[model samples]
Target: MIGMGSSRTQRPHTDRRDWDNLKSVLPFLLDFRSRAIFALSCLVLSKVATVGVPVMLKGIVDALEHKPEQVVVLPIALLLGYGLLRLLSAAFNELRDVVFARVRYRAMRRLSLRVLEHLHTQSLRFHLERKIGAISRDLERGTRSVSSLMNFMTFSIIPIMVEFLLVGIILLKEYPPIFALITFGTIAVYVWFTLRMADWRMDDRHTMNTLDSQANNQAIDSLVNYETVKYFNNEHLELARYDKTLNEWEGYAVKSQTSMSLLNFGQSAIIAVGVTIIMWVAANDVLQGQMSLGSLVMVNAFMLQLFIPLNSLGMIYRSLKYTLADMDTVFRLLDQQPEIQDLPHAPALKVAKGEIRFEQVEFGYQADRQILHGLTLTIPAGKTVAVVGQSGAGKSTLARLLYRFYDVTGGAIFIDGQDIRAVTQESLRRAIGIVPQDTVLFNETLRFNLQYGKPDATQADLEQAARMAHIAEFIAKLPDGWDTVVGERGLKLSGGEKQRVAIARAILKQPPILIFDEATSSLDSTTERAIQRTLEEVAGDHTTLIIAHRLSTIVNADQIVVLDAGRVVEQGTHPALLALKGHYAALWELQQREEQH
Candidate 1:
């Protein structure tokens, strides 16, 4: 709870700069520029025919008025012709929708993939500092908004603009100055009001979205710790807290909806008034012999057609505002440069003999607080080395350094005489396999989980690795065997089962070097003994480094390194370190006392 900052406490404020951010998403659309332009062109043609249909009906009416007897075939023919044109327009419209949908889906797929790739390249610290739920929510909302934005822009906004322009042109040809002035003036007023309402609602939508993310984060957190909540009988308290956040979210949502409703009502009223005034003027012109009744009918039809697109204009603007808000977070995430990035001309790591040497390495999570200070160590190939230390003694940090999770602040780490800093991260990571204390597994089948380390691993190889980890027998006893779903984060499996799965995955990877960060810390004594035997068998085949807290666990290690307060105080063979009466000896004595008790 120390770093917990309530998102609800951060009040949302709209910046006019959101429009600029929204414009930034346009480049993604521009990637398929040719297709987008073609789609828009087709949409325009369809809209023109759509607007023209009403005018054609006016022509039919006028033709009926003039002939009244001899034009039956011609009227029927014209009606059929108009119907065919409308059908063609509808087809074109459908085609445009299909093309744009493909374009939007492709763009979203590429963007999401890019974001994921970027995240994968980022350092462990970057992920540790952020909440998983928040990141997930941002990505999900951003993708959905971008897709909806593409639809709104093509199918709604652009088509509406074209319809408005066409209506103005038609009116200008018929009544010149009078029609142009009325049409342009109405549009200007409508746009002004739409922008105003959109500006007001933008902040509310942002607030609502922030609350949504918080609610999701809280829900995920509670669900993950459901057992703890039940054990403590705090389910009611958790529900109340969730309900409070939901109520806050509802408040902002209601405000946004109410504002939108008012905007819609105001827009409708303006459109009604504008159409009434235009009709009244046209009616006067017809009576005064300045315009024919047919012309007046055409103008009325065009007016009705214009309002169809105009009504959607407000909704489009509102959606555009929300899209901008969504992009703000997406761009913010995309713009973040990783704290640790590869060197421009980094080389691949040469094949290593599992010899690791850390020379005067200094490191810290923050600038003001250092963790490891001038620490130096070496582990030779094909040896089982144990790092024994109390918590926060930088034992885990040292293991992370071995994997290049964070570069040393000063000095260097070398693997097989090659500086880790000069080596490509991919190659370096591929050479090392780590089994973390808290094993994380995907919600997938056991086979998939086992093959995660080596995607192309054969079934025989998988079974062999599982057997070595002592998990094959347990897996066979399961209802679905290797095909059983592990559930989220391997929650379906016991801690010992999950640890064995992690070990099995690492074993299948067959890296030159292996790291075990208290791998058996979560297991019972019986399971630990089984895993210890497996570790001994694996040690003969690979260079293994382990962080051990239980003294008995490391008694057979080739070398035992004792650390205290981020510095190595004693290191030798287990028997030698125990005989030295140093820090290792003292810790061993304490552990033995606890075991006896």
Candidate 2:
């Protein structure tokens, strides 16, 4: 596909700018800054109480050591203090979780909404080229990563760092310099190993994500084309395709798990060796009358405090990295710029007479391959004009340009002499209603699909429109009536039923400018004639553009224009075109012969 405008520099996560990706989350979190600050404060208080537990236990030990007789008499104050510290630690941790819950979940909610709205703002080209399943997975994983990141930072990493600071201070103040050296040195080594392993494991994570998205995309695509698959009996072929991606994902997942096991074991060994060295030194100090048993107990308790959180550091670091990668994918989507943008402060389009004119328009989906070439046409105010042509004659392209799905490459289109480019897209679209050839309806209730054209339309308005489209009788006969659910893409309904629903929806909108691009092509001969009559009646006073393939259906149009090779070859009234015996006449004779048979 040819890029219509300047290409965007934004792409999916490719580099290791983890810090920049992390910064993208600040906007969502800033909304709850007060709550976030309270949560952090609670986290610090919890760690303070947790560290105090070891100190209180050391005090209780020393008090009992002062007298063996005191063994029978508990150190009541110290024991109570120890219990209170433990209680405070648990309470504050819970309080932190409670306070931060809104911040984390709200970030996820707001981010999801922003991504969705951004996708909507993108041009039709972007959606056409997107892989639904892969985008779906990205959206799911990205939103979830926000919660994971916040939870790990607020509850795990921050608290662990606080505890480490307290332990380092106590060790340096109360013990020999060698003790603090062993403790700090061991931490440095553990952190280094964990970060190194996490970086190595990141490759496996990225591979798994790619393979996983590919498999999901294939599965969804196959299911979406379920009828085609069944017709070709390609069940096994699809299975093999899905299995191939899954097999690769499985291999990497196993590798990731095995490597994680190794990292964990390495961490355990480092912690074990460090604790043994510290204990041996403390034991020697006590034996040499340089340290008391209480001092030894305090050192042991401090190691336990640090050891517990350090043990899980490897997994937390790996998960944090993975979450950052997920978040980057979403941020990349947010950065995508839409190809079609209205002028700054563009005004809404006013439809005074609804006269549309295509003034020497030129357009193409690709740069080298043009679809419409200098095509000029006009539909007078409150009149109907029909365009007829062979396939690929740019019949449908006219409707797309008029809808401003893509901007014209050369000349401009105008409504009531006002350039379309000068108007806001939403207002321009609102003034026009189109029933496309392929009428894909939402998988929703029949009433919902109709009301989509005018969300606040009343019941009488719906019934009147449905009746005009000749679909009301059919809907009334159904067991569920208007409440019937249209399956995905309206697959549950026949093609004719879907077309009728499309017509009803457009009629419900009742716009001044109406477009029926092959609108009746799906209906049977009887239904087609009936709906065609109704369409003629509905377009009696509206400025209507009818793009048709069947020549008979557009015989009564005020003017019929025949297109060939992206140019208007002939245009006149039905009798006048037949008299000219040109492209329109030849097409009429061809369709006439086909209809007779």
Candidate 3:
């Protein structure tokens, strides 16, 4: 398991023109382009209808002013026509929302599944080195940002551009140079300020997000180890620590919100000034008979229509900045390459009889420290072999080598005349089954856990494996029997029961090679005695390797190898080693003395 060490301070950096990152998600959208294109077409039509509203108003005003006595019904009908168009536009906008939501949800699902698949192919060491909580949070944040990006692209960017073009065309056609020049100039200024504000705000938001992740991770870490807090009476201390993290998060959050408020307020003031000046100039034109009253009304309405889309653009810009920041974290995780990877053309393993051999194997987790040094061992097919060692003697590391969890730095390990490293890891592992010292079980039913090794196993097969592992009787006594939900991490089951479940899973696998890494350490003496009988019965039909701390557990082994400081010190039958009176003999003597007391 990876330790959550002191939190590292992350510097906030926003990518300029991260609109390119939007391209990374384009393929997903392209896959559903037919739907997306239809949605965008509706969006464009909605904007056209929205723009036509002000034009209709201008027409009604002109018709009523010029021919008030002729007929009032015509102008009234024009007003109702514009109202219907607005209603239709609103309906299309709502429909567009539905389409965008489907795209967002589908993209999120695809990305999350890809991340899961990549994680599955990674080596065990990668998982051991990473914080699971942090990785999960990163992926979640990325998916949400991608969804937001899709929403903005469809609803904000496209509609805003369409609105801008319509307003420009209307201004040029009605009130030539002045209206067009002022509108374009004001838009330029708005874009500049929006971009500047977005740059600063994105930086602040990134900091806030980092702080939030840290605070969340700290709280989860504390909760997961609640027992430690209670035992140490450090609940108050942990609470204070969490409170500090929360305060830091609040500090950044406040800064971000304050900046956003200032930007919005400044932009609103600018828009108010520009709109006031343009209307004032139009009113002067109307007085001089250069422009009609209806045209003035139309110019004012068009400006307001343009501002609506521009305002939406501001919100989209902000969202885009946040989406980019989130994507940065996610991309970094996806880019991480596992230290161990499969070789091209790696052949599948086929072992008829499990004959294992280690030829001068040397290994280490790091360059400076060697855990196994030139270790050599051999176990003939269908033999029961035992490895006895003190803590840190590299006994378990040897078993890991057999499964190619980490390739040996020197020499080789072979099973049935084939080098383990030369075969595909999947094939190599499938031929062997391991029952680790610390059994892990999901929060699932007894039947589900048992079937994990053999998903297609029948009820009869499950029961047979359970009986062999001495867990069927205990499982039957549960309230819901095989349907009983094992609480998180099998916390609902006792240590012995958990181990028996693990054993049953391994038994169901029925691999040709079996490894027990202190398998009975969690069980009571009676439970161990019963499991020992099961082990003996199974050993006759398979090649078994046992790493034992208890000398009595492996006393009947065909051969026992005693290791000290990463090197084998003795190899012989248990009785023969006792007679040799070496390190193994000394260990046996110590066990006898301790048991007598």
What tens digits encode model 3's per-residue C-alpha lDDT throughout 1-597?
223354656766655346566667898898889889889988988988998998898888888888788556888889899899899899889888877677778999998887888787777789877666667787889888888888777877878888888878877886768888888788888889999988867766877887777667767777767778889998897777777768888988898889888988877877877788888899999899998778888888888888767766777788877888888777666677766666889999998899999999999988999999999999989999999988999999988889887899999999999998888888999999988888889999989998998999999999999999999898888889999988777888888888899899999999999998998998898989999999888888889999999988998888999999999999999889989989998998898999899
TM-score for each prediction?
0.95, 0.96, 0.95
Sum up the clashes in candidate 2.
Answer: 0
Candidate ranking (TM-score, best to worst)? 2, 1, 3
Flag regions of model 1 displaced more than 4 Å. Answer: 1-8, 16-27, 30-34
Q: Mind giving the per-residue lDDT tens digits that candidate 2 earns over 36-125?
A: 999999899999999998888887888888766776556787888899999999999999999999999899889899999999888888
Mark the regions of model 2 whose C-alpha exceeds 4 Å error after superposition: 1-13, 69-74
TM-score of 2: 0.96
Candidate 1 lDDT over residue span 115-203, tens digit each = 89888888899988777777899999887777878888888888887887777777777676978788779888988998988887777
- Off by more than 4 A, model 3: 1-8, 12-20
lDDT values for all models: 0.84, 0.90, 0.85
- Candidate 3 — what's its lDDT? 0.85
Estimate the lDDT of model 1.
0.84
Q: What TM-score does model 1 achieve against the real structure?
A: 0.95
